[model samples]
Target: MKESDPNKKEPIGKLISYIHRTQLKRMSRSLGEYGIGGGGQYSFLKAILMSPGTTQDQLTVGLKFDKATTARSVKQLEAAGYIERRADPEDRRSHQLYPTHKAIEFQPVLQTLLDESNAKLTRDLTDEEEDQLIALLQKLNLED
Candidate 1:
């Protein structure tokens, strides 16, 4: 096989990977001041805030993250005083996660940050283009 040409168009997966890394870097920088480490920590916090008493297993599945990643994110959030874990009423072995007062207070700020991030990401796109992009991406069949 011949070496790939540099002039060739980049693969879709490569473009997606680059975009994901860029977004993560931006989000990490923005969230660091609030003691929220990146790697979807904000996502976990938001989910807990939206649906308090959700279990780690549910987060893992809902967010398409591995169990270990979910556990690690939960631990970090707990250490940062953003969330708490309580014994599940239905199952003693499982713990239900809840956002703490700090997280509740930060919810609005988080929303603003996320909105700003999204705006920045799509600054060059027209409203219709952005909607079309979202619709196209959603059609990629990302379900597990």
Candidate 2:
């Protein structure tokens, strides 16, 4: 009898990491066309799209990223013309980030890529299984 691959029994972390790496690679290619690189900037842009005029501090907290990391991503996005930062009238020391027209125009394309990738990943699963998987993943991400 042939031996089964031990990797088949690898922990969920390995599988999740693999998926994240593959998605980042795909995003690097797909988003490069739009002048966005991998480095987690996709999520940052999406967050700004969802809430225009969000503060840098808000982004740091919302994304669970360090302040410096958020600052760097914000700077890159701003320089790339995907986002514009304006002084927050409410908070003189902080700035609010907003997606520019260029970034807004790429929303559908990004959404399509996201949807297609998700469908491809869950293609073999039934609706119930998909829902259960989503629920389980969400549970895992929840703060204890």
Candidate 3:
């Protein structure tokens, strides 16, 4: 195959990958200002959003995290007032993980931050271009 000419078009994939990762890290740093950072807290918040009463073992499966790490993360999140664990009446040793009032209140801010980040990333694209990009990505998914 002939090598692609950089003069014709820049390497969009590589640029997007680098910028996306960097911007994600930077955007997530804002979470620290609200007393949340690192240690699987982001994953924990996302999991609780999807599964309000999920158990730690369930989190292990759903989030693809290891046992010890899952336990440690839950402990930290619980202590931070981001989540609450309720004792299972049926299962003596099992506890269900749910979002705290504080976390529930913060959901809109999370969504706004995500929307702002997405907007920043795609700020240069027109509506038609955004549609085309999404379609192309979906087509690539089919190839995989």
Which candidate's lDDT is highest? Answer: 1
Report the lDDT tens digits of candidate 2 across residue range 4-71: 69767867887898887887787778788778877788889999999999998899889888888888
In order of TM-score, best first, we have: 1, 2, 3
lDDT by residue (16-93, candidate 3, tens digit) is 677756675856686778766665467778789768999999998887778998998888778878899999777979
Please, what is the TM-score per model?
A: 0.92, 0.87, 0.67
Per-residue C-alpha lDDT of model 1 across residues 31-128, encoded as one tens digit per residue: 99999998989999999999999999999989899999999999999999999999998899999999999999999999999899999999999999
Candidate 1's displacement at residue 16, Å, is 1.2
Predictions ranked by lDDT, top down?
A: 1, 2, 3
In candidate 2, residue 97 scores what lDDT?
Answer: 91
RMSD of 2: 3.2
Model 3, residue 42: what's the lDDT?
73
Give me candidate 1's TM-score against the actual structure: 0.92
Q: lDDT for each of the candidates?
A: 0.93, 0.86, 0.79
Off by over 4 Å in 1: 1-8
lDDT for model 2: 0.86
